[model samples]
Target chain A: MRRRPGIGGLQKAAAARDQYRLLGENVAKLRTDMMKEQLATFRSQLEEFARKHKNDIRKNPAFRAQFHEMCAKIGVDPLASNKGFWAELLGIGDFYYELGVQIIEVCMLTRSHNGGLISLQELCNHLRQRRKKDREAVTEDDCLRAISKLKVLGSGFEVITIGKKKLVRSVPTELNKDHNQILELAQGQGFVTVEEVQRRLSWTSGRVTDALETLLEEGLAMIDNGHKDGKCRYWFPCVSSVYSSIGSDP
Target chain B: MASGSSIGVGVLFENAEVTTSGRPVLRRNEVECFLLSSVEFDSEDDPPRFTTLKSGNLILTTHRLIWIPSQSNGAVPSSISLAAVTHIYSHKKSIKSMFHSPRIRFQADPGAIVVTIVFRGKGDIDGFLTKFWECWRGRAWEEEEKSESETSRSGSGTVAQGLYGNDGTVRMVGLAGILRKEQEQWESTDKSLQDAFQDLNALMSKAKEMVSLAEKMRQKLLSAPSSQNGSTDDEEMGSKEEMQQWMLSVGIISPVTKESAGALYHQELSRQLADFVRIPLEQAGGMISLTDMYYHFNRARGTELISPDDLWQACTLWEKFDVPVMLRKFDSGVMVIQNKSHSDEEVMSRIRMLVTKTETLRAGVTASDAALTLKIAPAMAKEHLLTAETKGLLCRDMSPDGLRFYFNLFPEIDPTSQHIAKDFGTYGVWVKATSMLSV
Candidate 1:
């Protein structure tokens, strides 16, 4: 009310403006404090829900039997409310699942590609058959360890046996636990190699590599660029290495 | 890695090692004092061969003799092991011998190269002889052998105590039972040991260098008890306590004192420093503040303490060796020695979970709060929080109340639109958290 004084016009008017400004500052500080408290509450419930959902998907027997390993990236343990915990876990759940698939994908390159080849040599032939641009042969050790990780998750992917030959591919029956964002990021690129996915996402090497390794294991994606036509491709039944071939995790 | 050559009179044989800094590494517990150059050896029974060892430095220690080649070679020069000494000839003052620079001759077998040390550097030759004779008689090699056995003995005892006992037998008693028995043993042992160690005079004379040094200092301080006590107050007492603590840490049985290491002082000191850093490093979760290390290293050194500059030089030398530790200086000018394999990512993830939780988001986490979660000291926890802040994994809250940290929602929050959660980001979770707290 003290903007200016009329005894001399300026002083009374200035006094009125100062009081109005002081009142506005008090209201803004009060509002921020009140909002902060409310935000802290909602956060807890979301975190809890996300965490439990991730765990259920990880431990479910039907799913466990398909992947090598599954883990719910730690969400909230002590301080977060149960609801808040799940929300946080759910946020990153899809990425976690993708890492599992990539591990399986890398493993597939070692065995056989023709009806899942038997040995490293056959795997190399499969990559050679692709004659696709920039496709490389996969090694045995990488495939074995990645598969072994699945078992650590209390789950094992389908290592299909073709007759008596040692041919297996860990396929999660339900691969679409959560991975749309990844597919979105790919921009209809379908399943791709770790290097390609990482480049496209502009994510750190570790994060992309982890997700791609998960994608391959889910059988949602396979290394297919090697073919007689030499066109590097990731093929799926109706989707073409893109059967939404993404799973959050075991 | 070795060969048997004539090894000329001036040429050094095997059993030599040089530190990465191009300084000669010494045998365990060998402390150096006097240094000289152009030194050589000759014997009464051999041919008139003269060792043409040019420009190399000579060193005398209480334990063994040491020599180092120059940096011009781009590598450490070869040195001899004094443990191989077969005989030591007494220096004579005969007419012809007096004309030449003083040289000490000794016989070391395996090839009987009758080593001659030519002292050309400016140092007291008599002091060098005094120390050399003291070192030779000290039998440092034997002590080294004993220390190895002692280490093995302690290691095995702990393992045995886990499975059995020190009597070369497995007791297989439950830990509670063992603790009870040990408690009894300690009480009895403590009394007798205390009684035996009570003599002020005998304790002073017991060849305990650090203890005597501390005792002398303590007595001098006590003489003026109150009249001068105020002047020697808390800081004086702190230093006194530190002196006592150092004397206790020097329990290494035989420290590599300067009197024993000669020209190779800092280099040998560096290796010993490497071995010594392991315990403090472990206690500090594979890393420790350099200031902490400085205190620890000097305490371990006792009377032969080194300066901070030496500690830094030693830590910098770790990169050249296959040692499992390293020295790191944070951008904050806080220097630390960390295990090479220590992972900041693991620590960071743990802290992320800690501060982002509903309670921490509401109340925030002081260094002590992080200490509880990280299971470390508050000071160390603060360093971790600061590191996380720099990495954008966490952020700080400073006000009149206190400084604290909260998990960073930088990745989750849409900074351009703070209120919107983007349907599924960390910011969404954060918004929910504050709401839960308010309710």
Candidate 2:
């Protein structure tokens, strides 16, 4: 104000630097250093978060008990709700599974929760327990590209805006036959995170998180992310329930 | 010895005419009938051997006999005309002459070098002789000379109309005097027509003669009304003038035929057809059908008509000549003669603009409609339309209204998916173009 270089000039210079940094960061985050050892840690922490948040279990004890019994019959722990847990259970690391799981979780979460304008970054955070060095923001372009790929690979997921920022959701139908695999993997390994579904549905350039958002828009599953580490999660109500209520995307 | 005898220097052989292609220019109304190839000419009394014209072709026309060097697969075209063949000596039946190339001895003036026609190639001698007799006897030039005399006489009379009478008597320049002269002319014409139709056979033979008669009467009538100071109605005069013009243009310069073109029949016939087609080819806008020209050409030829096969052979001969007109065959098996400079690109561009227009797009265009716009015959216009369709510049709409053409939209249509137009596209233009229909 006192005759230094004008404020606009200073702001422009700062914005240029910030843009350069943002490009570098996004390019770096696009790299997938997917390793079994690294994924095992993300899996256990994500599972613990989902297990600790038992509001649905407390509210519907009969259903929770039935879910556990089903998991027992399937020979998998119901509390193992992390994406890696599901991927290991299915022996897959692709992102479509994570996306499908994320969409289902979002639908479930939206039924009981309201955090206005769910941003992709906030959703991604809810899907994985990220390290301080790994907290990259999800971009609109990233989300768009990922959802497009999920549509191509026959994933029944969608990304939508509720209150403004795009949030992951599921299509109201499971007409996309490949989406049934998501339910199968989830049932076999208890539950999959939104991140796991997103990873399974990876397009040419889509990150795992974008895949999760798309699946939630399609209502084949349900999701939740209100936990300490913000690891968003998904659980199918029942395969028959989703199929009967939803129609295919022509 | 019949060697080099001419009455005077630089006489250059009597009344000889050659074609533009150096074959032989035909007299007006002359037609080529038949032709023979491989002939030599020498003198009966040991003249210098015109040696081995090696397959030289002889042509017989309605008017004169022609000799052309046979165009073997590849040979320089050389020719000579026989308008001066005044007499033919009786052939000597000696054993030596009989073994030689079937030769005929003929006497020609003014040199009177008893020239011998030696047929060195295989051909029908009686056929050639019959045609030679027919052409020599036809005396076509007599008619031309008579016509030319009448033309000169009429030309001189027009200049003499002011003061002198038909008998070269001086007359006063008055309207009444001119009217009396014109009336006398009309009465003469009326008398002739009455005499012409006296017998039905006379009338049939005199159809062309009637045309000439009408021409004479109309000329007489035209001068009459003007001298009478518009005594007759303008409409009657106008119709009469039109009828006269049609009758006057009823004659063709040359016609191709099998009778006149002896020995070299179709070859010379081909050249004559090529020359005669120039005017009609121009009128048809650089292209015309063979069938059509056959009618116009034969009508102009008068007595000698050509068959369709003769016309085709003539057209095919165009490839051998450096003429301006060429024969073109379309994919649909239609044949035509076109100027060498004619281009499909120009025709295609015209059709492109035609189909894209608003009215043409909606209503489409028929071959006749295109012909009218393109200023060409309907058949030729149909060929252009079909070619345009093949190039994908236009598409055809075949319905009860007959086959019509419209601008093609095949390229504009996206076959991949229902990805709608992206603001500026051929599809958008099409939509805007058709939007007027909606409003």
Candidate 3:
């Protein structure tokens, strides 16, 4: 209408917009830097908290859970490595390394009984028995973390699931599908009958017997033909309930 | 108390249904039409025999008009079947009516009682009334009864008779006639399939029939083995069993929909979902990823697919109900559904057994290795392995060969005596295996 203030006015408006954008970016950058500084201070405070409550974290499961939660909120993984700030502050790495060694001792001692397979609960119980005088209490989580660190050794130490139970395996025998299936079937009552396996799995008698014999040869299963039913039961000691091993020493 | 006795207040509705979460239970096919919160049931009768029920949720369902108290203050939830609602009083618009909360009066039951529903909460009262009128006039309950009876009667009826039209010409009397009829059926089915694929609506309409057909085929397959005894081969039986399993997983007959459940959609969906997950959870070794469950559940639901947010809300609502399954979020932010009885201790013991095997001792296990051994998803297996590692049952090996787990022999190898193998331990066995590899 009135020449619309021409190109000069438009250039001035564009310059102002660019200045505003730059100002906004500068404010955002400042806020981010301030956040980073606050985060660093918060992390240092958390480290202090962890250092103070180290004993409680080691001894009490509930307290340990809370500590882990705090660490998680701050994106700090105490179990990320055996080196660095966490290990330097708490010697948690050495503690697990010691526990891992003790675990191997127990597993080796009881290898003949369970055939290189032991329940995690039983293993913890054994560790507790061995470390009775130790100030730090060992939980399942602690043992698992220690074991994870032991992976660097290249030993065939790992955990496997059979049915609902978790069993620590120290041997390197490959369990075929049939063997795993049989083990899983035996998990419910600690033993599976040849007939029961055949019926449940819809496998022929030959297949069931062959799988059971392989498990037996592998030392993963024991033959139990003591039942009056005259059916042979394949017992997986690793997955059997704790009651079955009540009288046995770890 | 006096009003309670005068109004025959002792269980007015005999079949008073409530879910584990104390939400009103809906009858099969009896969809909820409308819902109004903070409604009061008042006795407008002259004798004032019926006690006024205060601050309750009034629900209009196809089968019944239910009123449940918000708080359990000695007042029982009551309902008036739509069948009993003889007359609905027309809404009277006046200056006084506008000033007060909206109300709807209706004549109900054997006692000639006039009940007034007072909407005290912020709800679309007009909308509720419209649905109530529509449900009463629709008589959906009668249709449901008719269909249920028809299905039950057809259960024992001959399938062939139903498929063929009654032309009084004995068209399918023999094997040859049956073959010819089957060919004709194939042609018709092919045409219907083409029509179904032409549009989404046609596909949806055909989906129900497809589900029923699958169910029928499954029933036949299930009965086939028993009837034939030793006549069927192993391969035939195996394929038949597989087909039956697929048919069993075909669809959920009545999926909970927002329109059908109204305000109680998520609550009802949660309960239904809890029931639905029982089998799948069992099959997944007591745990399954939330994402996988979403797919399985939606596949079962067919056309009424739910959103991820809806599924999440439904899962979250499980805490309020007495459900066997629960939603678990791992430390890695992975979400899964697992049975309450699925103990981590059990899984840990199994893992311990797997790694200690002679073969596994020489060559460590990958996530896929654990998955195959555990009969579970690889991702789930990795979580289990990580959990096992945390428990010190297994240790991880990260090299060019990728991540693998070994039986934690670090503790067994005395760092002070790294070269010397323990005579009776896994370290000795490992030494022997490695030595053999060199040979």
Which CAPRI category fits model 2? Answer: incorrect
Candidate 3 lDDT over residue span B1-439, tens digit each = 6445435644345436775445567675565556677888777564344454678877777778788777777666778789988899988889999899889999887677887888887776676777778889878678668868877876566444222232343354664575456456445544544564354344334533433433433343354434344554564454354344344334454566675556767977897788788787887567665654665675465334565567888999999877878888755345678887785877888888887766677677765467557775444566788889998888887864456788988888777878876767777777776566567
The RMSD (Cα, Å) of candidate 2 is 43.9
Give the better candidate number (1 or 2) by TM-score.
Answer: 2
Predictions' DockQ, in order: 0.01, 0.00, 0.01
Task: Identify the CAPRI category of the predicted complex in candidate 1.
Answer: incorrect
**Two-way DockQ contest, 2 vs 3, winner:** 3
Docking class of 3: incorrect
TM agreement with the true structure for every prediction: 0.35, 0.41, 0.44
lDDT of 2 at B368: 43
Candidate 1's TM-score: 0.35
lDDT of 1 by residue, B180-245 (tens): 554454343334334423442322232222222223333433332433324545634543443333
lDDT of 2 by residue, B1-439 (tens): 1123321211322324555654666554555555666776565454333433346666666655555655533323333334566765554678896677787667665566676677878777666676566555555567667878987887666543321123344346554564456455444444544554454334334434444443333344344444333455563454344344344224443433443344456766677777778887787567665444654554344323344455677778888876767777655344567777774878988988887765565556765456556765344566778888888888887764356778887787777865775345545656666665567
| Model 1 misplacement above 4 A | A1-250, B1-107, B114-126, B133-250, B253-271, B280-349, B356-364, B376-380, B398-404, B411-439
